[model samples]
Target: MLEAANLTKKYKGLTAVDSYSLRVLPGRIHGLIGPNGAGKTTVFNMLTSLVEPTEGRVLFRGEPITGKRPDRIAKLGLARTFQNIRLFKELTVLDNILVAAQIHKQYGFFSAMLGLPSYTREEKALHHNAIRLLEEVGLAGLAHHKARSLSYGNQRKLEIARALALAPKLLLLDEPAAGMNPNESMELMGMIRSIRDRYDLSILVIEHDIPFVMQLCEHIQVLNYGQLIAEGNPEEVRSNPEVIKAYLGRSAEHA
Candidate 1:
């Protein structure tokens, strides 16, 4: 559902992402893996238009969206979560999600200003949807709690749930398992897979967690020195000489 063709990025004459390309098929999980400085996040930024690509373009369902603004991209059904947890710390979990669902509101300004029945109806629908999303992410009981009071892993889940408020066709998750312990990570794995199927969406993930990424994604793309080094299923990537030499060994042996 998403494709990046020959994407390249340079900053002050240093190339960050060089001709990186990958495809995320419908309803499947695709992985982007690389060592530090490999430009995985740069690719995500380019796709989301947080950074313009120095060369090439990105396509969503065959439409070129190379340099669209970040809001435009999100409006067009591309949603994502950051490597670092980002939440409205003081807001309740339900409010955080309600904020995101605003992007899809349809009532006119006249309706809003007049407190017309239409706006009120839309507001009620959004609130219900937000509550449903919280439940889907396993935060139903904490809907009224302040975001900052949740554990680290629940914070991550809340971010993902908020992203879902956009009703995206493609979801990009950067380091979804970054801070979780083994049990938490394992739970996240199942949750990711379940949500992908439940929501009927494609996912592209950039993660340093080897086993987590391999086990979760249907296809894997490996990067080193800001270039594509290998692309295949889990076994092919793990046994590839270049991947093993560049970063896979350390990843495999990592606790």
Candidate 2:
């Protein structure tokens, strides 16, 4: 579970996020949506410690993690994917996941250099787990292929797979459906649900795809001009007057 209190971020004259607060319960999926420049990504950066907040704090499972290093936060069981795909283009897909799985290494570098039994054993286990993670995201068969060779949607899934290698308790996904076609988006929705149930994960996603968020998230929060405008179930948010006038506007009619 994660909780953010009065989170605010400013860059010189601009307040990117203003007093935004929200909580994600265990094993639940939550969505954050807003117009461009609404600071959705800024909130994520603050939560992950990629950027320090100008004010307020973040709690992950009750411990404050506001200024912790991103790797430290990840080691504590939080992982995230970027809006733009970030993959090691030249690495084999399996190797890309193997890189993330290094967090679970139980042996020292000397052990690895000497090919000690402990290092070999742990490395073998990580390989097995990486393959299993790739399979879960429907990319097992492409494990040996170069990461840059996958299709756009498949690349998105690969990023999620790499994040899963971290074995996170909470996952923050930024625009997971950004470039997917309708069919791919639907597949991703199903995959996300399966992951939540199978991994017992709590997900907080920031997505511009309205219908995708509406169908995937159990709870939704709307932001506009760096301020929270609405928070509710999909139906409640879809019908809220303030949300209609703010982020959704005329799009609400189609939504």
Pairs in clash, predicted candidate 2: none
Looking at model 1, residue 210 earns an lDDT score of: 94
Write model 1 residue lDDT over 1-255, tens digit each, in one string.
998999999999999999988888999999999998889999999999899999999998888888888888899999999998889999999999999999999998899999999999999999999999998989999999999999999999999999999999999999999989999999999999988999999999999999999899989999888999999999999888889878745543451
What TM-score does structure 1 among the candidates reach?
0.96
Among all windows of ten consecutive residues in candidate 2, which has the lowest summed lDDT?
A: 246-255
Whole-model lDDT, model 2: 0.94
Q: What are the lDDT scores of the predictions, listed in order?
A: 0.92, 0.94
The C-alpha stretches of model 2 lying farther than 4 A from their native spots are 248-255
What is the TM-score of candidate 2?
0.97
TM-score to true structure, per model: 0.96, 0.97
Residue-by-residue lDDT tens digits, candidate 2, 23-127? 999999999999898899999999999999999999999999999999989989999999989999999999999999898678998999999999889999999
